[model samples]
Target: MKKKLSPIIAVSLFLAVISLLFPPSSMAGEERIQQELRDPNPTLNPLQKALGKKGYDRAMASGKYRYVGNTKCRLCHREFFVGRKKDPHVYTYERLVAIGYETNKRCLGCHTTGFGVPTGYESFEKTPKLVGVQCEGCHGPGSEHVRLHRDDASPFGMGIPRPRPQKPKGGKKEIKGGFLAGADNPRIIKRMCLSCHTKRWGRSFKRTPHAFQAAYDLYKTPLPGDEGDQ
Candidate 1:
């Protein structure tokens, strides 16, 4: 005996079948949003912005425009400095020397820290500390930053953003500190790398990951295999 179902019941059954075939948003909901957020080369977050004019002004105003070498940075960032020693960049000069190209100007430009800056690497004898690619290589000359960090009047350090002071009804008012300018912005990092990773200079490096996400990961990861020049 065949009994016909009501129109409403038939419709409900059809919808249930369809729902099984294609689940509701809740079934694959928040994970999609999370996946989007987890994209490796994500655009800069809202907190980041280019330094532009402000950075230019500060660079010009900073009287301490000389390269202080990686040793100076080690005082504050010992862990990072240790990690850098494991990085290939730290041995750039050594690699050049090993290959008998130590004095080659073309190689020296990228092999040494602050190659063109004042008080920068001149010769192995003159600036032994600046022999390899160093912290100031990307951060620019760090002499001024180091001085300000030590100075009691305006002590600041690496990667600090500008702080806006609020007027409170307290005994002493607060003074705002400036941000790290382009440090957080990924684009600045890309440009800095590209400046040296040009076609002529970067043969093997071309195969390496250039994205900020990859670079960030590499910064933290310990070097693999042999420490010798390859």
Candidate 2:
């Protein structure tokens, strides 16, 4: 008569047989997916591709300016702020949450404003204000700009002063505020937009060369009370 196998031992043997039938590579791949899900600082290849290696290095080089959230931006740019609230970028993080990828670092880089950078979005609890893409997401950090604008004497000073057009010692004209002005750095801004809106995200740049510009135009469309204003 054959000896009776204990339930625990039988179960263990069954699992061992299953592992033998399936290669470790398949199991490893599943493990890698799970590990990525837990990772908070996964590689941001899209961002690197958008900015290029040098640009990516420069953008991540310093943590000088801190993100002050969209509310602080609203203090001065009420119209732009309100307009952005209706934009899809504002709810990108929430979209990730709905799909159960909120914690996935791969999705966070595009969904959230800034990730894996100093003073950037970390977690919902840690940085609730930075959860969504806001003014700083495209304009870069605004701490210095906010400070300079507050010190300006012009009543209509909207944080951006008239460009002096003076070339510094290096021959490169300096932007008034420490922010990335769309008029001054159109290329950089374009790259930033394309970084997230790539083919992978269903944004067809190849099929429609002007798709980005069209979307940008919509972004610039003035709100009800924002006519004739920046």
Candidate 3:
């Protein structure tokens, strides 16, 4: 008589076969992230670390905004999206891939939009639309912003007027329509940029005092058809 496989071993073998056939991309991505989290080295980014996991989780959960990726942003900001193709930020994730750190959680925070957060980038296979440092990376999550604008643009739209900008409370800057206005919040923008552009990363923020401002200027440069809008 042939020896019977143990229940645990049989279940494992069955799942392995199923995975081979179905190839759960999202599950694989989650597993990859979990694996990185289990590693001895720290995986959370500077901002995430500052918040602490629980604090960060709470902020993301309470925000009620989701990352809609660059594709959604392109619907309205076509010029900016097209213009960004020439910018180096568009290829940030490819840079990591070239260096064989594509799945490195430590680097993903800067390399990809919204990594390690809710509704954020997972693996390229799972969240290909969010592969690079897109608009949401700097502007914060755009789900609410996109939804509001899209509803306003609808032909059968309700005639409800957009909400007036509310005064920020508690000295905390308020994001309008679920988006952080980077131009209006220079300090926040600078902090976001420097979170990744640290001395340890060989960024010239310290060596060149004006580097951040210069980059910010470049970031805000209007595309050919965007001058009047700006």
Whole-model lDDT values for every prediction: 0.53, 0.63, 0.66
Number of clashing residue pairs, candidate 1: 3
TM-score of each: 0.53, 0.65, 0.65
Task: Kindly report which residue pairs in candidate 2 clash with one another.
Answer: none
lDDT of 3: 0.66
Candidate 3 — worst ten consecutive residues by lDDT sum? Answer: 151-160
- Kindly list the per-residue Cα lDDT of model 1 for residues 103-176, writing each as its tens digit: 75545666787665456688898889888777766555666555545543223332355433233244221111
**In candidate 1, where is summed lDDT lowest over 10 consecutive residues?**
172-181
Q: Is candidate 2 or candidate 3 better by lDDT?
A: 3
Candidate 3: TM-score? Answer: 0.65
Estimate the Cα RMSD of every predicted model relative to the unseen true structure: 16.8, 12.6, 16.9
Comparing candidate 1 with candidate 2, which one achieves the higher lDDT?
2
RMSD of 2: 12.6
Residue-level lDDT of model 2, residues 112-215, one tens digit each, is 86776577789998999998777777666677566655644343324565543333355332134555433356666677777666533433344366756766
> Per-residue error at 161 for model 1, in Å?
14
